[model samples]
Target: MKLLTLNFLTCAIKACKSSPASFPLHPRDVELEIVESDINLPFLKNILPRLMWAELRTIAAELGLPELPETAPTRDHLVEGKEEAKEGEEVDEVPSQTARDLHRVLLETTVKEGKLVCGNCAHEYKVMEGVPNFLLPGHLV
Candidate 1:
């Protein structure tokens, strides 16, 4: 699954659904693959506001990807001239290395195989062939 998707996932066990640690399940024994695609700067800028930036940065580091800054690009950072004020270049006009890294981590990288374990309940979910099986057994469900 794309790293972005992990941000939305939580442990499937009903008891752990409300637990904070259940969200952003920690990846274990992960196998990563990069499938390149054209970087869409506008899309990146659009989704920036929605991501859990800190959690994403932590997961990226856990997966052996380059670290994302603690702070993500603000909407103003994507504005025509605002980026120059902070980064000395308009990010909308010329995507920065940070933007590129975000694109790569969120879009290009996929987990080919792994298990994501709930930090709270320790429930394990298997990922195979780029698909995460969040389904729990009948008793758990």
Candidate 2:
């Protein structure tokens, strides 16, 4: 699989396994926190086979964040694959994601420093220097 996809899956799984108190993180000017605790099955059905709904819900509950409700809100409100509206020199696209989009999302998308975990694959990714420290041990290999 592609590195990004593998990484995202592994991290998501780790988040689901670790204790919330031990979540690793990178603090920014505005701070970073997982917002949703509840999971809306209707909203999640279309994401992909890789997303573990059970894991996601478990992680959210652990973090004390609530997930979205089953109903209400517009369709695709919580879906990924949405692209940036602009395409100019000021903002460049990086593969599937734009540089600005990636930057904004990446900063908000770090595992907690000491207690980081993934909700999908249950793989752990440490956070160091305000960045995710994703190093895989040889056991899985």
Candidate 3:
């Protein structure tokens, strides 16, 4: 799955629900794939408000991906006063860099194989072929 989807996932253990420590399940031994796709600025902007910035940053860093900003840009920052253009540069380009970064990190990148382990419960959820297996064993359900 995209790193974006992993942001909202948590340990599947029923007793672990609603615990902050269980969330942002840590990706371990990840295999990454980057496949180019059309960039959708509007979709990136829409999801910015819902992302957990700090967790994303940490995970991305752990996986050796390009660094995202320590905090997500405010909506104002996304559409604010334009960037200063050099003689040959686009005036609005700098401001959209954040969106571009988000698009790359959250959309273009995928985890082809890995395990997402809960920090609190130490439960592991396997990811295969870019799909995370969040199913709990019958006993744990």
Residues 1-141, candidate 1, lDDT per residue (tens digit)? 888889798888888988888878889899998989998878988898789888888788888887777788775554445545665543437666667777899999988999999989998899999899988786565
Q: Under the 3 Å rule for N, CA and C atoms, how many clashes does model 1 have?
A: 0
- Sorting all predicted structures by TM-score, with the top scorer first, yields 1, 3, 2
lDDT of 3 by residue, 36-64 (tens): 88877666667777888999998899889
- Residue pairs in collision within model 1: none
Q: Which regions of candidate 3 are displaced past 4 Å?
A: 76-95, 139-141
Give the per-residue lDDT of model 2 (tens digit) for 18-60.
6543322212222234323334334233333444334444443
Enumerate residue pairs that collide in model 3: 1-130
The Cα local distance difference test for each model comes to 0.82, 0.36, 0.79
Worst 10 residues of 1 by lDDT: 83-92
